[model samples]
Target: MRKLILAIAAALPSAAVAGGYIVPNTNPRDLSMAGSAMAAQDSAGAAYANPAALSKLEGLNVTGGVSLIDFRSTWTDSARIADGQAVTMIPKGAFPFVLFAGYGLKLANGMKLGVGGGVNIPGGGYSFWPGNWPGRYQIVTVDRKVYGMYLTSGLQIMPQVRVGGGLVYYRTTEHLIQGINFLGYDSSAELGTSGGAVSFDLSTEVQPLKTIPLTIGVDYKHQAVQHLSGHGHFDNPPPALQGYGVVDQPATHVLTYPNRLEVGASYQVIPQLLVTAQWTWERFHVYKSDVFNGGLGFSLAVNRDYKNGYTLRLGGEFQALPQLKVRGGILRDISPVRPETLDPTLPEANVWAGALGVGYEVMPGLQVDAAYFHAFYDTITAAGADQAFPGTYDTRANIWSLAVSWKTDLLQRRK
Candidate 1:
């Protein structure tokens, strides 16, 4: 009841806010160490990370953040090039959005219930530089958008424990584009796809220690199956050389859906300070299909889908004043990618981060928040993809971000 609305402390800048190589495969935020799910309370932002935290909110709230990812992925092997020519430079971009809204109501018995939803960017791929877009292949663009929502109810089942659970729904759209050769002619082909899924979350918050001002919460979230496919189209067809062929743009690639699991926790050192952590698991090997083609309108090929991976996050905050805060966090992204599935498009790695922010109350029921953060990643290989590709190439990336949050009371005055 003493926490004031924060604006700068919760928002992120452009670079760290979007999906990129080192930042995160998904949306980045200014919340804390654990960028995805935070230890925040009262604000509508908690719903995206843990629905059970929604009951703690006292009013109707809305929050949204954007993460802009900047990176470079290049092809270094002259042998991989079609005509014995190698690529030295590459440029790419990914802008991801994370939206959130929440509302809470108190019952006659004093228990709380809440609901919230949003559009999230799980990941993206856009590695198009100068020479041949790297690897033994190229991708003009790889964009994806995902949406989901949840309704949760928390009951003070006992004096020290609160139990809660909720159902979730997801929707998505993904677009893919790649260019090879027009066979001496000038032609292009691009593809687009759409898919969705459903999931659930179960959580509990408990006050285990009485002497220390503290509370702990644990949450689990799972996503259902999501199927995806993209259709391709040809523009202008080029000519052929030596009968082998020259393509301005070849076919496209298609993939199926996968599942995900997430677990997180939050701890408060005092009314104005707290720390948090989270782990996420995603299964891509469940992906099945064959051939990454381009000759026709699409590309298909057999692949050794990678195993699941984990993202570990940790962050905390310090309130210099009632309305100001300084924060920082770090994440280790150990991908389960195999040497065979490696492509220049999605080269996984580990990332580190730092952030600062401020929040304010301009008037009753009205508030504004802002935040800043920086993320760093170590180089990794995008090898094993494209039968034409030979070895894993070297690469690295950096993400910087800034964000804002605004909220007002609709039904009641909550945090």
Candidate 2:
């Protein structure tokens, strides 16, 4: 019995985002416009969003930026209280951030090349309470982090058509701790895992009508499966479980990060005014592995049964002045988690988000950008049916970002 339980604990957690995870727009300038830069990428973000748009960029351009995300939530379970106290848990707000940098070069005859990479802390939060808390057995502390890097390129097929794509590498790390009753003795378990994988992306853009100021773009990113291996440790084990001890297993489980597809269009309403809309589809249904079989007869599995999800975004940009531009947009995303699986590890929910931002030309070849975003989510509730946790989860988040990019013709002049 002890061996079976320990083997189950060896499996790590999984990641699927319908809200507050897998942020598509990493550029501060684009985030300001609610990630509407798909068809109107005027900055160095082309390398990440739609590499096909690179042809629209000129000369040598370098961009750098960062985004700060703040997470807040409260979990309540009246039936699980132990000491006749308030049945509530408020997670300490977490400040996770993303960093980005990219460079693009325009070659002769409408050809473009770009290389870029960044770090994304898509989803992961920490929760803590006294060891005697009623929900202690469910969870205590969970720290999960995911990040990725990529390189891309683009070319103009015709005067109004372009195509692009790139390759990516991703990594995820997780740590979880929970309390258990062992022969009437208080005991705790710690589990850890870390692994990396490779993926790729493809994109294209076209102007269907030259007489109109309209541009359409689309992109696809392949899914990644992280194969991780780690260990489990027990503290203060009771005599019955003393034989289990500390077990160190290496590289055993696998987690799937869903694939994604996005399509966007931009229309210039007037000379200086532009409007854009985008739709994104996440193939969460393809995520089937709930258990990871680490080699050496060690394996773990959990049931997620996630469903596919989508996001809709709309934004507009105005060239208020020759040197300044203003932008705003809104988004609605559906959650992928099925109700029975809602737990502290991933308290996900449907969300509505809005953003406001602006860009300014510090000089002829230098641009600075800034934007702010807020997300509101629906409360999640479960009655403990089907053996799932019984409780309510309320959550929300905020983000702030800033960036700078420089475009120069020095390379062209040197030639």
Candidate 3:
């Protein structure tokens, strides 16, 4: 029983890392531009991407969107224990949604202010591997979900400068299953937990020169730590181990989401064309380890040793006609997961992605946007890592987005 408990505890840390991969911007308009719209304050998604941009809006602006994602990966175990066995893992399609509404008003004192609130999915995913696969001991299945709700306010302090801040609430849920080998008997362990946390973000936008037609935007998100508590259930244990401490029990864990910073600049070269370039940095180094506590009087800490990561994006939008627009962009994303700690549950790697999209104005004050994005992940081979699963990993993903947006000043001016 003690050996079984130790083995299960040792494996839990790897499973805990499953859902940490960050999801891109959920707004289809922003997504179509390869998520490079931080300084392009023409849409309501600014509530989440860069709240300060909200001040640039004239009156009432709203956007609602959905993103459908397909994630695929494969792992090949080269270690002697597995004898070069390969397996494929595919998560069911994920559909994450977003909704944001913002209102800009002129106060009696001649000050401009914008207020907004909404919800979005920032990160989370699901993956399943065959129970009998060579790496089943590491993980079999992982399902995770994360949701973010925020209330933001932006102030146009000066004709050329705007600033904003917001309070955000994050909630997450996870369920994990992994195989356990005990005394020549095959068993399984499952852990399920849900938790919530609160954090904040700040943003600033500057139009350095009125003649330059250039805008620079910066946004920062604070880190958040969530405490999760749930039950750990052991199944199919041998009869001889029935009397041991292999029964179901409560469990607890802690997860620290990383702090993020993004800076971007957009320039309007002509009345019909606009281009943007953005850079994002995440403090993933804080994710050094994961600690798990089982109510049965034992605890385990596993090392992750993740490094900081970044992404570079460039995109452009063209006003083809009075009622039509076309967009395209490219991005390079550097992963935070180290080779020594890479696992199949979430086989994250450096990625290169491209996106194409279009927007149509159905009528006055109403528009629809759609986009398609594809990611090509670089292959990774890890060997001689102390805590890593030695293997070769390959992964890729596809995302499709659709959205609708509306804007109007009549509602706010009626008063």
Regions of model 2 farther than 4 Å from truth: 1-21, 78-133, 245-251, 294-296
- Per-residue lDDT tens digits for candidate 3, residues 1-415, read 6434434544433222122457888587788888888999676777889888788777899999898888777887766558777888746688989999998887777668898889998877667888898888888887777788889888988888999989988887877888988867889988887888999999999999988999999999998898988877888777787788787878778877789899999999999999999999989888888778878777777777888989999999999999999998889998888777777765777889899999999999999999998888888877454744678877778889999999999977788
lDDT (10s digit) by residue, model 2, range 303-389: 667788888999998999999999999989887777677665566688888999998999999998888888787887754466445
Clashes of 1: 52
Better of 1 and 3 by TM-score: 3
The collision pairs in model 3 are none
Give the per-residue lDDT of model 1 (tens digit) for 164-220. Answer: 667766665655445545344433444555666677767766667666545566666
Clashes of 3: 0
- For all candidates in order, the CA lDDT equals 0.50, 0.70, 0.81
Query: How do these models rank on TM-score, best leading?
Result: 3, 2, 1
Query: Ten consecutive residues with minimal summed lDDT in candidate 1?
Result: 1-10
Over all chains combined, what TM-score does candidate 1 have? 0.75
The candidate scoring highest on TM-score is: 3
Q: Estimated TM-score per prediction?
A: 0.75, 0.88, 0.94
Model 2, position 292: C-alpha lDDT score: 55
